[model samples]
Target: MAFYLVTGGAGFIGSHIVEKLVRRKEKVRILDNFSTGKRENIAPFLEKIELIEGDIRDSGTVTKAVKGVDYILHQAALPSVPRSIKDPVTTNEVNVLGTLNILMAAKELGVKKVVYASSSSVYGETPQLPKMEDMQPSPLSPYALSKL
Candidate 1:
């Protein structure tokens, strides 16, 4: 049986992804700190998922959670620009360092592709209408720079 691990699977978009994976008849697990994610989001499909309530910045916790997972979806992040601006330390701890923890765990466990979520605020104050992937960034906020 193939196993899938979704970090921050209790959040809005992460919950949707976890629901789809569960519907597809795949073995799935979740890692969430519950800092921003709401419990109600995943309450409907609790049976199918093994929820691990822990911070992603903790490598030991993350590493332990990565076992027996064939695929990984890293959706955990400090997504709000305003929050990132006001409290960048926690934002970086969760968004950047936590993402790094996921990457390290994935690499060590030999898991397949890991899709990590990123904020669009990296687009900065550029007047460019349609933002492409490769744009010279001009970040106006700390959150924007962090994402960049």
Candidate 2:
């Protein structure tokens, strides 16, 4: 089985990813601060995965989590536009700086791939219904801009 590290694996989307990975019998490790993630989300499969309760912004924690991992699925972030507006500093610290930490760890550890979960809001408001990836991003909020 392949070993995987899933940051924010206790959150909504991240929890689902953990579920799928566990079902496949992959060895999975979770690193979540639980700022936004709930304990109940991961309660069902606690024994199946390794849990590391920590923040992504901490380089030491991130570096430790990335060790011996085949892939890094970076899903940790402080989400929501309104929340970002209310506290841009916290949002930037978690989203931007946290992501930087993940990238740095993955690069230093020689991990082959890092799958980052970027918000679709990066596409911004446009007349185009099906927001194409090629389109230039025009972020409307601090959260959207950080995702870009």
Candidate 3:
């Protein structure tokens, strides 16, 4: 079985990923500070998966979390355009710097892959139904900029 480390695994999207992984009987680990993620989301699977309650910004915590994990599904971030606009510093710290920490840890630990969960808002408001990967990012808010 593949070992997967999902940051923010208690959040909406992350929780779903955790559920699918558990269903498939994969070894899963989660690191979340619960700033935005709710306990109820992950409560059901607490005994099934290993969970580390910590922030991604903390290097020691991230370092400890990354150990022995093969793939990292980087889903942790301060996710809100309006919230980012309100607190750009926090947003950048959590979304950008926090992600950098994860990437650095993953790289140093020799992780096989790191799949980042990027926002479609990076493409801005266009008539396009499906935004292509080649499309240029036109971020309107700090949140969008961080995602870019």
Candidate 4:
């Protein structure tokens, strides 16, 4: 069984990912600070997976989470646009620096893969339908910039 680490595994999207992994009987581990994540989201399978309650901004915590993991599903972030505008510093620290911590830890520990969840807001408000990856990213908000 491949060891999978889902960061922010208590959040909406993260919880769903955890549920899928659990259904597949994979060895799952969760790293979540629970700042915006709810306990009830992951309550069903709490005992089935290893849980580490910590912030991703801390390198030590990130390293601990990534160690011995095969694939990293990075979903942790301050995902609010208005909140990022209000507090860009914390947003950058959590979204940018926190992601950097995950990347560095994954590389150092020889993890096979690191799957990142990026926001579509990076494209900004374009009238064009069906956003393509090649389009120029015009991030308007601090949150979008951080995701980019």
lDDT for residue 120 in candidate 3, whole number 0-100: 90
List lDDT for all candidates, in order: 0.86, 0.93, 0.94, 0.97
Model 2 lDDT at residue 88: 96
Error of 1 at 97 (Å): 1.0
Per-residue lDDT of candidate 4, residues 1-148 (tens digit):
8999999999999999999999999999999999999999999999999999999999999999999999999999999999999999999999999999999999999999999998889999998889888989999999999988
Off by over 4 Å in 2: none
lDDT of 3 at 86: 89
Alpha carbon lDDT at 9, candidate 2: 98
Top of the candidates by lDDT: 4
C-alpha TM-scores of all predictions: 0.91, 0.96, 0.97, 0.97
Error of 4 at 125 (Å): 0.3
The clash count of every prediction, one per candidate, is 0, 0, 0, 0
Model 3 weakest 10-residue run by lDDT = 121-130
User: How far in Å is the alpha carbon of 64 misplaced in model 1?
Assistant: 1.2
Using TM-score as the yardstick, the better of models 2 and 4 is 4
Residue pairs clashing, model 1: none
Error of 1 at 75 (Å): 0.8
